[model samples]
Target: MEIEPYVDTTLDEPLVPEPPEPGSILSESVIDELNMTVWTLSNGVTVWLKPTDFKEDEIALQATSPGGWSNSSLEDHQSAVIAAGLVQQGGVGAFSTIDLQKALAGKAVQVSPSIDQNTEGMSGSASPEDLETMLQLVWLYFTSPRQDETAFQAFMAQGRAVLENLGSNPMAAFADTFSVTMAQGHPRSRPLSVAILDEIDLETGVDFYRERFADASDFTFVFVGAIDLDIMRPLAEQYLGSLPRIERVDSHVDLDIDPPDAHIQKTVRAGVEPQSQTIMAFSGPFDYTAQNRVGMRVMAQALEIRLRERMREDLGGTYGVGVTGGYEQIPEESYTVTVAFGSDPLRSEELRGVVFEELRKLQVEGPSQEDVDKVVEGERRARETNVRLNPYWAAQLIGAKASGQDPRFLLDTTTIDAVTIESIQEDARRYLNEDRVVIVTLLPAEMIGRP
Candidate 1:
């Protein structure tokens, strides 16, 4: 499949669209305690503006809306993944990929579209002076997404080459196996393979992109950092307000992907290296709430500290350990806590036993005051730093609104401070059930002798 050759279409003068009248599209702006302004645009696109001197000449912009992979069927999942990458490679409107690069030359502006489990949107940063250019690019993406067969084939060829030997790599195989195990045979959880890539149609992927981004009304645009409302309003009206609006109210559809109910243990023998990787996952249906989410995070941190001490220092078994906990909002609201480590294949079982012991200890004795204090202080410092940044606010506001929570929740720190040892212990007791755990181990073929 040969791609269309790039042709130079440079002209003596570049065409630029005229800005719309700012006064025509009125907005209702509400100033919050954190000095952020929430503006509801006439076209139903909500805009969150936080003017700051954090950076002298830069601003961050994020536009997000729900209905991502949730909008895709089992057969179309691979297309959804390829379409996001194709959008950037295919360029925007009439500009070829190289031509688009030439058009953006010498400008510190970047914008890219992406899709996840529950949302799809674009995010980018630009200099204050180049805000119009940023909005223009965004407008082009939503209005005229180019479908270049050449770019699509090229991207697929590159992806195929990379994935050709992916299964031969032990870590990659483990990751694939782990995903399937956690998802319990859900169609969306299937690992990417050459067979799956072969099924992707360039035209179908492009059409999927168009269908997902068809309605711009549901999107909320968040802009933060060195911004003046007077300068931003016109650009917002011209590019965002002028977007094609449809009477469509779209949200993600739950596909009902859930973890296995009973405990599972799987061991994979691969690669030639003399090492083993182990993952212990505990998950269950959880009520999605602000306080519960905070408690899970705090519990993960406390557990991480204890794991590092026992696994790395005391036993000298592994170089390091990783622990993470989070709740997913789609399918059904559920939380997972995972602890993973790499160690000698011969001692894999022993090290895993120690990890379980620590969990049992946390359940029985609970974390100490010192452990709670360390996590709280670390969280406080992180919150203080993130509050001053634009990307942080952009992500926070988008997530809050999508989950039907108040944007003001970003400003509330009561939950973080309220996390006590008792609360974390209670959460641990409820979530970390031995009967519901999933343990997966990957060992070298030589160490475990393939059956």
Candidate 2:
């Protein structure tokens, strides 16, 4: 048999099979203030349901629970980190990769499971008509994950090809060193390399994945879209409620991943292209709360405006600049703020001086009233739009749940509406303290007299 790339476009028919039916569920409680419904299955799974008419035929779901690579034992640590990616490559349940594709030839549905530093779960979407197939896939993923050796070897081979001659790209050298330095010698923080391939095996990766998703008691599944509470209840209970349930207390383990304690600086040289880049990072311990999180967001937005003004507009040194800073709640309560941009190697020193000058201004005086107002206005508009979207609600609830943050904060707009100059300055001083800072400069390789 030969493969055919052409489709039979002349046929007036859909190749898709029939969709699955909905399930029944009982509501535990309804919070009118949040306009949300909650249900607890007999098997210990929690479901958060919010109905919306945003899209006529769309729904988004995010199921999450505590425990990630951070919770793995030393023997399974490396495998756990890449477990989600590897497991997904192999087909789920009783379907081979090709068989699964053939089965889902014309369906608008997708589901992916992933494990990060502090969380593991499923993220997927489907039309209301196909919700049953979506849930069916979910149940199969947890109960019967396939361990196909052929798929595993193929994934490994692809990995080797990607890692081979990776250093040929200049950014590769700079990025590798930057990651190792930020990890501060934490064994688990090492970047993926060829050696990692040897340390991790197919069976170990699949085994770790099973252990992470084995228990559904701690997981919270949020469904938002055009939903009929009456129609979805039974389907959710049948597929999701039936997932493996075990009695266990699970949480992310602290591997002591810390940034440099003192101010440190390093320079990297790579590639032949005439380009250079610089990154300035600052981090320290701080109060992790909703109000503080909003405040930090405001400060970062304002700082970016000022940097864009000076680095690109005033000096005309680079094309653009970016500032990213936020507080972490899981495994540790800490903050990190970083500013980076590209410039000529000769002017790198001059531009370096400018970066610190801006830093000093932000630390002492904060952005202008106009800048603060601009940031708040933009944020208000974004929130206004975000609150109406389903994905926004799904991400907010699941992320807050995973990080141990207060989900009630999702409805609070007082902080964003009441942002002041003094508050921005205070947040800057508190989180971006100078004690913990790492600066890295990336310059082009040698070239003496090229005109």
Candidate 3:
């Protein structure tokens, strides 16, 4: 469908609501160690305040909840994706996207909502003077999200254009194949296709987004940067506290999206270049503790060092390689470690063998003290830098609260010190099971004897 060009002149002026008055604060406390304050608002919404002088005039805002695609049904997947995309595209409250832009022309503020596999949240930054404007925008998103059909159609048109020739891209095809295989063919795991784009309903999409963001009581708002609690408390009470509250206590349900339990290998022949991409993935359930999470990171860093030495430096099979470890609290607390790289098709299998060899070595002999020290030092430096940034604190606070963890865990730097080489080796043995691995190799058509 061809969408009519949106003309700003014909649209009516947007109805901007007045800023809410400061509401009553029920309770407040400070964590002396972290230098942060936690406030329980009269409306039951928790607000975290961390005053920092890192950016003299900037403040970061994050509003998070535990419900996301996990709160959506399989049938609503397409709608949910479209809804989240179009929600901000169409604008909030009575403002059209164009008008909203005009309204905030001089303000240094940004706010957008997102729905992930297991979480939904909004993140943006604003100048200290524009904090009330930021709160007002947040209130609008929660209370009144305008659905413009024209914006939805335009978004879908752009999306379809991007997906029209996606199959022609060999790397894209390989990524889709890898996702499908790893997700065990779960419907939600399927990559977006042109057909799925046509299946999305605008009304359904809007409703799905609204349902997930309906209740404000379950939401936790975190604000960080150069701001005073005395001044912020009243603004938070008026704008955030005045949001409509509902009694819904929805949380993400585990959809049982697990990787295959047995060893599985898949090879795809595509593209014309004489290159092959390989992903060596190992995944399983894990205890979602701070200590365990740190242990997994240590293992990934150590494994990357070994792979670089064997695969890139010694054998010269690939230019570079990467090892990534991820832990998810929802869907039953699990961890996945993926080793990915690209190389000549002829040497791909040889490099793949080396990947396993490194894992086996870690399982038996464990990472060297030198390797462990390198990872620990790198982590320490990163943590030290992150603690001084407002964006980092915002993310950490929201994540910790959503996952039912102590916010002090973010301030605790001792976990890295406690991650011993033995713990990393144990993690390797427990998580790197050969039977539970999924290997995907994408080779050139010529290499696989295909036209």
Candidate 4:
């Protein structure tokens, strides 16, 4: 038997390239701490380039600017959200979505547009050889985003279909209630519904997308992995440098969204599954600092370890429990700690008490030295491997720039030493507040006889 190598016919006869108009790099800055270089283009686009031989064929890129949909009208939040989403589905430049796919058939290049609460941008990857193609797509997304009515209609139809049956799902009902309750009546925080979907217009989305991406002045572009500075500089200039810009920079606008300052509990009964689920949350104002951020994670990881032991290993109450906690600086400086899990409908209250008792114990007596050390050791092992990788560097590099943190911290392991049992206990006391706790539980609808 003989096997022949596969050939991509599309690649054998490549489509004509749509190269960006020529432009030049205006200036450069070297952050000696991180061994990365930053360049400002003639047209004001900033690029952070980190060269690494981590992977021979890998390059990851992210270009983001402040002023996500929140910067748009809060009343039109759904439209702004849909606009960011439809850009990728609709198409870019002269290519239809299908045409673009066909054109990119054999290229190791990909990119997608996104809009989040405080930022909007593109994130994707390409092989080193396909970097120029990646740049071309980036330029097209900025210059000429196309709209497809068919795609728009299909997207909305699918959305409507999902919303139509959402009321019948216990998890969906619980989530909607949880989100609305936590957001404290913020209009922008409402969950998806037929009414919300009906008010969103594709045309409105397209317009908002254009406005958000219209200017590249405030955008910071990050590229990492297998970088060839000599090769990328000109491509960046030609593609990103030539992007349209007005005399404007964008910043995130807070919609004043925040969780409430009081404790409350609510239960939703739905579904046929004979089970119980609960989300116990604690939140309050926070002082967003580097030390506090790491401390919060240490506390959460330690708590996760405690929960797995008390609720799973010892009590045999359930198979697993989930614990997550983090602080946010945007809109307001605040933090949320959430513990969630499923268990027997009869034992839900008992399990909930276990969680509270463990939390209070940590706050009073602190985690053992072994628990703190485990978290630090795990972080060390992870970071040891992460430092040699591309995506980690890509994220951390951008994060350092965004937070004004010293880039040299990327190499400083001294921070981990600060994670002691005493510190963890102090973090528990400082951050976690039972006064702000919100407990939302879900049980079998028939079991509760319809709450």
Alpha-carbon local distance difference test for all models: 0.83, 0.81, 0.85, 0.85
Candidate 1 error regions (>4 Å):
1-24, 448-451
- What are the runs in model 4 whose C-alpha is more than 4 Å off? 1-18, 448-451
2 against 3, candidate with superior TM-score: 3
What alpha-carbon RMSD in Å does predicted model 3 have with respect to the real structure? Answer: 2.9
**What's the TM-score of each model vs. the native?**
0.94, 0.92, 0.94, 0.94
Write one digit per residue (lDDT tens) for candidate 3, span 316-342. Answer: 999999999988877688889999999
- Cα lDDT of model 4 by residue, 1-451, tens digit: 8999996443232232556677788899898777789999887788999888889999988777878888778667798977867888888866767778988978899988888888788888999989988988888888888888899889889989999989688899889889888988799988889888988888888889999999998888999998999999888888898899898768889887888888889998889898988998889988877777788888999998999999999999888898887787776788998999999887888999999899899999999989988999988898899988888888777677665567677777777778899999998887778889889999887774333
Runs with alpha carbons beyond 4 Å of true place in candidate 2 = 1-27, 447-451
Cα lDDT for residue 323, model 4? 82
Clashing pairs in model 3?
Answer: 21-238, 22-238, 23-237, 23-238
Q: List the residue pairs that clash in candidate 4.
A: none
Residue 304, model 4, lDDT: 88
Candidate 4: 10-residue stretch with minimal lDDT? 8-17
Specify the poorest-scoring 10-residue window by lDDT in model 2: 11-20
